[model samples]
Target: MFRFAVLLLALLFAAPAATQSLQAQYEAFLEGTIWPQAKLAGVSRKTFDGAMGAKRLNTDIPGLVTPGAKEPPRRMRQAEFSAPAKYFNERNIGYITATGRSLARKYASTLASIEKTYGVPARILLAIWGRESGFGRVDIPHDAFQVLGTKAFMSTRPELFRRELINALVIVQLGHASPSAMRSSWAGAMGQPQFLPSSYLQYAVDFDGNGHPDIWNSVPDTLASIAAYLKASGWVPGRDWGFEVTVPASVSCALEGPDRGKRISDWAKLGIRRVSGKPFPEHEARAEGFLLMPAGRHGPAFIATPNFYVIKEYNESDLYALFVGHAGDRIQWGDSRFSAGWDRTDSMLRSDIAKMQRALEGKGYDVGGADGLPGFKTRRSIGDWQEKNGRTPTCWPSNALISAIR
Candidate 1:
């Protein structure tokens, strides 16, 4: 009993001592490693000190790796890559659409000016705004310095965070925003448009003639910044993002990807029809359109234009782009759901997907690094493999597909 009590006391004291040591190391890293790079990046010492002073390592941030501890195996094995139906929750979509329409009316002139200036539509801007931060209503409560500093000092992707941390200091040095005014998400994405520090420097604009790009409280700045980013990312003028379509059985699902783009007229000739039963727009008929099947044959498909991929530059996920486009349509033209429903599929672990990706890689297929996510490469590879093996191409991973690939 006496030894146990002594051991408990030792552990309690030792934990604080270890934490203090780590904190000291973190401070040293800020001064030694980050300071030199930040200085080289044109950040003033005073600005760096002001921003980083009293900043402590945030151990609770996701994807962080301890200084000297072995990283535990990734928990992706436990995560099931399920159908994307939940991404478009009706309640959430309804709220965003209704609120977006109201904001469209509220900021009518501003939206019009932004659309004219940036060549991006008002509804697209509003939808991106709503999706990013619930039209600037969602709380973004993290300090930019602390989040960036912690990730820079000890996260899995330290180099990325380190660059962002330096850029964050530069943001302060340039008199753009003060340290206290700079609020960010947990991942260090600042303000309503959720841009990282680098993106803020490159894309954020002072649209309300305020002379400062205040994305946090200024709705015009937020909306304009989103448009600027999209425009820079190759948003085509006067082009719609995409249209939901009925891809015929004759059209191979394996033919889905940005690289496999065909003229909209060519796609029309191949028997693809708009789910709305309307003809492809006459202006759009000459433009290139890519096949987009987010859920293989299990859900809605789209004939995505270059503008669709431009939206993907904002957020890489196909589902994210779809949500923004669909929500934008609803915001402009009342509530209407996608024509096709998401078919239920068996849940598969990400690790299992990785295994399938690895197997495909062994068979000379480029599944795009076996990252466990079914990116376009992985999806197309699966369909190609199925076709080669005399089976129907689903273009998605499943339990049977996993076993067969092995």
Candidate 2:
């Protein structure tokens, strides 16, 4: 009993000592590593000290790699890659669309001026705004210094976060925003548009003309900054993002990717038609359009334009761009759902998908690194494998496909 009591007491004392040691290392890192980089980035010593002095390591943030640990950080828990339907939940979409429409009217003149200057549509800006932070209604509760500093000190992607930490310091030095006023998401995305500190420096705009870009409070600044980012990302003026279309069985689902673009007129020749029963605009006929099948053959497909890929620059996900575009459509037009429904499919673990991707890779197929998410490359590889095996191409992962691949 005496030995057990002494051992427990030792552990209790040792825990605090270990924590203090880590804290000391973190302070050293900030002074030796981060300070030099921030100095090189033109951040003043006062600004750097003011922003980072009291910051401590935030262990609660996701995907953190503990310093001096043997094993890597555990993969952050994510929602199951199930039906794509859940992504387009009616309640969430309805709320964003309804709120976006009201804001569109409220900022009509300001949006028009932004569109004239940036050449991105008002609806698109409003949709991205509504999606990003609920049009600045959502609380961004993390201090920029704490989140960035912790990630830079020790995280899965330390180098990337280190660069951003310096950028955050520069933002403070340039009088763009003070450290106290700079709130961010746990992932370090800041303001209404969820831009990183680097993106803020590169793309954020002072549309409200307040002598500085205040993305946190100024509505005009937030919207115009989104527009400016999209514009810089090669948003083509006078072109729609995409159209929901009916892809016939004759056309291969593997034909879906930004690189496989063809003139809209040529896709129409292959029996693709808009689900809305409207003709492809004559002006767009000559422009390039890529096939987009987010769910392979199991859900609605789209004829995406270059602008669709441009939207992906803000947040690199097919579903994210689709949600922004679809919500924008609802805000401008009316609340109508996708013409085709998402077919219910088997739920599989990401590990299962990764296993199947490895099998494909063993067979000389590029499944895009087997990261578990079915990107365009994975989807097309599935389609090609199905075709090779004398099966109809679904282009999506399934239990049967996983079994058959191996």
Candidate 3:
């Protein structure tokens, strides 16, 4: 009897059927969520089918990070950030810019009409379009359900994906798009506007009055829908996003967090002069904002507004926001210079950044150590050290960063 019981238990343990593999579970979830979303979004049935057939999760995309990977021997650490730009060279930027220009021209009438209808600036809308899909240059990699479903299974961001999946389903039910036609990034953002399904539900517009918010293929619809998002995000019609400014030598860039926000009048008093060599003259140049020095003293400086935060809603990275703002400026004026000064040298590698983060943490700095990359807190610590040592306060880590490891 004991031998029979042992054999039965061993058989049960070997099969382990109750816990499904991650891939199988994800596919099951995707099928259930995608179809309903497709119908509601009004994606043509054919478009839906094409996109669905082409869909697959991006399994090899790492967490979009590389913190603490061991450094390669005989390498300059700064190559990390700079290398990407090197690969995405001038030709790439030119192609990207031309694609944007073409899209802008294609939707010229709609953009003008939307600009008139919504007080959001035309260039800002175009900039968003340019960056998101590279004016539709980047391929839509995965269908909405599969991407979100995979992320939901594979990440700590399960709740976000779960909610997004529901929104995708809602889109199909509402006739805004179809399940198969809802193509987007692996993170689940969709359309030329790169809107999440929820954002599309709230902000997408049928600007040509075609009765469908066709952001996927309709140039007018996509451009106008972007305008609608900005307007709803509280874009202040004609106001500048912010201005490049030169700070007094005595001022500390470390003091430039969102917490230090003050009115434009307050900024003028602080000797924050514009790159234009004049005081800001528009949009209540007195509106409150915080200073931004992206690479500390080495990069351009700007006094940006709460509305700038709204654009960050479109994409979260400071680099992204700065690029968009600068691109907007470029559309208005060609390759205008940044005022904060740039380090032009490459970036520290992931392992180096992890080492730096660990060093900072060892000194009671409270930086979450060696996770993979340095963030705002780590940069602020560098600034603090620079100010103490009477250095330039560039916030970038250097050989000097290794010393005084607290």
Candidate 4:
């Protein structure tokens, strides 16, 4: 009976022992696996040791699992999708636009120079700057090496983070920042621009001519680095991101993607008109535009340009692009809200949406990989499916449709 009690106690404490074993394995991975990659990437032993030697695993980072754990139950279903209306809280948008205007005046010459050099406008840069880190006012408070190394060692995408960790070491070796000074977000996005180290290496620039791309502190470097990223991603010079428009029902929301673009003039002919009652800019009229109904017919719509997609390259979310573009417009053109009101759509779990998407795919409709978020493909597929079932197509996801599609 005493032996049985001891065995029970040992089993009860086995979990902590397993966790300790995993942490040791992660440390070994750093020394053996990460070291070679960093060394091959030209990170010196001194810099590597300085940055990585004392770093402990940050157990607090999201999405971590035990080294030998079973495939975890899907937790994505527990996450509730927020309404787009919630994303555009008036107070938040107001703060971003208000701050953007002030920064625009304060950095007029620098912004003008950046626009001239990169062809990305000052308003766009200001909006991004405001969005990324409150134009550098927000204190990013994690050590880059600690966050990157921990993520690289134990994250869902370890290989990707391993590369990023090596890149971060390269940044340190280049003398751009000391290891101690290399602050980052918990997710390892660094500086005012919130660039991952690889992105920093690719796009960060020495705009202030201070011998370093000081995105951590220099306003010129932060704004210019953002412009450089947009330009590199093929932002169209002098072209607008997109225009808020009243998309006619006759013009199907299925037409909303980079792959399916038509001349703005052609869309105008199709009864798509700008909500402001102004004509599509004469130059833009001849250019291609894609329909962008983020919430399908359930919310505001847009006629997104190639430049609109470029904004998306910064952060892939449609709402993110819309927020940046709209905030920029507010700074440049003054306050104006979306013409159509965002409907109070049904809340859903991303997993349920993924299930709907898979069901749609099985029926020969493309829902863009069952990744949960409704892109143009998913939205159109939903609409097409609704029409097939003899229902009026809203071209958006709904709680009722979750069961209906399945």
Candidate 5:
């Protein structure tokens, strides 16, 4: 019986590779299936192979790509949103702002043209440039083909990866970029603007009129490409990213996100006030927005607009969206004060946060139904509990709190 069990375990371990085949088969497929797609797309096979041969499947990276498997969200706050609001003050703002302004100057002409053409704000573009690549300080390491191939070979979304892998090969064949030059993020985001191969094909532009949309090496092309993507994703010029505001003493707002836009007048009528203490502009009085009290009622709050949602398309997570917004906000103005209150403390791990969400829901507080995220309701409950128990209000969760509520 023990021998049989050993054999069963061996087979279980071997079964996945048996199902997917090894890297050799993957290589042959690249030569066979992928090359044909490239030829049809006007790429030479020699160029395809030579450009791609520099790198190999990064088995480690594919671990980051599988979908529907149990893994953390790509980004999460290191602590409760309230904890950092105080530290994200004028001194830090000064440091980040200087960096942003310098990057803006470096990309000024390209930025101006991109803004004129795409309706994305220049400061926002500069902020992204500064943040993602450190104003081009960082160098890309892995060739994109290997990165894409590794993900394709191991991804839960095999169809998506396969398509992207083929697209990378096709780009090589088109002479748009060599395999060696296609180095980028391990997840296969490439170039100055950090575009996916598919996105590069779709939205990247040759702003210099240099005949190639050279995002990898050309500054103008990359900024323009970034701008183009933002425009397509619904960036509105001249509007602030959104305002940090305090919710009114009376209105019961719930589960509103940047995705849920409500007119500013309507939100104001409900008692939302700006953090800066001045009234919201009349022109934007009717611009729809959703209330997001990030640290609960005791923490900081914001009214995120459609443009806020646009930044999320650039990156999916709320924290990433906040980073982009706050970075831009800091660049535009110095040391903006907190809009809402916070009971600052360390954050729960994402998995813990998920468990806490379940606990909170069972206790009759709605925490947006536990998709492994902390949001308004979850934060609010933490705040309410802390307020009631003299714990000084924090958005983070604890197993002890769960035990108490139970």
Candidate 6:
């Protein structure tokens, strides 16, 4: 009985059946899928073969599973939604701002030229430069072809990575970058600006007139590329990203999201005032401003502009855009922090949040696909639910709320 039990255990844990091993699978994918795409993208056989011939798959990249393995559970139970306050740690922000100031002076001429050409502010470009790669001090360690190819062959989003892989080959074929020079992040974002290959192809600029947008080693190219990307993403010139504001109790925190935009003047009439005691710029008064309460009413709030949303196009996270804007303010104006404080809220596992989101969605509330993260949709839905249940709306998630909802 013991021997039979041991055999059953071994069988249960055994690897899935496959005609080809992982390495063989990777090689087959390269030849069958990758080569055809590369050819279609106009990459010569020499460049494609040279770049991919001996490259081995980096199977250890995060968010990967075996090709034929059972899909993992949708909810990441162990994932903790990090505290909003922690995202704006003074030490980290200070380091970025301080380093940004130094680089601002060091590359003043380059930045000035980039700003003139792209209509993006030097401070904003410098902030993104510092934030993305620590002003190129941080080393990008993976080979572009290797990272993208590996991800394409087996990662969760294979199609996306496959497209990126083809674009990388296109970059090489165009002689924009040699394969050896194409270092990237584990997720396959490349160079100082950390753009994916498609973005690189579209936005990278040869600022120094070197005939190639060498974002890897050229300061001018790196800064210019970032500016080009922002410019392409519709960064409004002469407009501020956002201003930290005090949202009066009368204004519902549930009124948060890009879709809920109103004129800056209208927002002011509703008693939302800048924390700095300054009025909204005359030009922006008639322009649309969206309420961005990242942590609902529990944390700092802002009246964000279209330009603010443009920054989010660089990175989807609200915190990320705020960090860039705040860091730029520090470098350009002076050291400043958000006037409002982030209140402590009860922590809950992302799985629980997802459960709450699904329940709300089933009730015809849009919590935005029941993802673990409590985005604007989730936050507002929570408030709407609260108001409907005769509870005061907090517009934020909490453990108590989860229990109540469940």
lDDT of 4 by residue, 67-133 (tens): 5344354545321243878878789889999989988888899999999999999988888888889
Off by over 4 Å in 6: 1-20, 68-71, 74-80
Which of the predicted structures, 2 or 4, would earn the higher TM-score when compared with the native? 2
Separately for all candidates shown, the number of backbone clashes (residues 3 or more apart, or on different chains) is: 0, 0, 28, 0, 7, 0
Candidate 3 residue 268 Cα shift, in angstroms, is 2.8
For model 4, what is the alpha-carbon lDDT of residue 270? 97
What tens digits encode model 2's per-residue C-alpha lDDT throughout 67-163? 7444352333222246788888899999999999999989999999999999999999998998889999999999988999998888878889999
lDDT tens digits by residue: candidate 5, 313-358: 8876565666677877767665554545456455545666667678
Off by over 4 Å in 2: 68-80
Q: Which wins on lDDT, candidate 3 or candidate 4?
A: 4
Q: How does each model score on lDDT? A: 0.91, 0.91, 0.67, 0.87, 0.70, 0.87
- What C-alpha lDDT, on a 0 to 100 scale, does residue 49 get in candidate 1? 85
TM-score of the candidate numbered 5?
0.78
Question: What is the C-alpha local distance difference test score of candidate 4?
Answer: 0.87
lDDT of 6 by residue, 114-203 (tens): 888889998888888878898899999899898898888878888899999999989999999999999999999999999999999999
In the range 201-294, model 3's lDDT, one tens digit per residue, is: 8888887677779878777788878877877877776677788888777777777766678888788888888888886885557678778765
Better of 1 and 5 by lDDT: 1
After superposition on all CA atoms, how large is the RMSD of candidate 6? 2.9
TM-score of candidate 2 to 2 decimals: 0.97
Clashes of 2: 0
Return the clash pairs for model 1, or none. none
Model 1: per-residue Cα lDDT over 1-406, one tens digit each = 9999999999999999999998999999999999999999998888988999889988888887887555555645321257688888899999999999999999999999999999999999999998999999999989999999998888878889999999999999999999998999889999999999999999999999978899999999999999999999999999999999999989999999999999999999999999999999999999999999988888899999999899999998888898999999999999999999988776777878889999999999988888778888899999999999999888988888898898
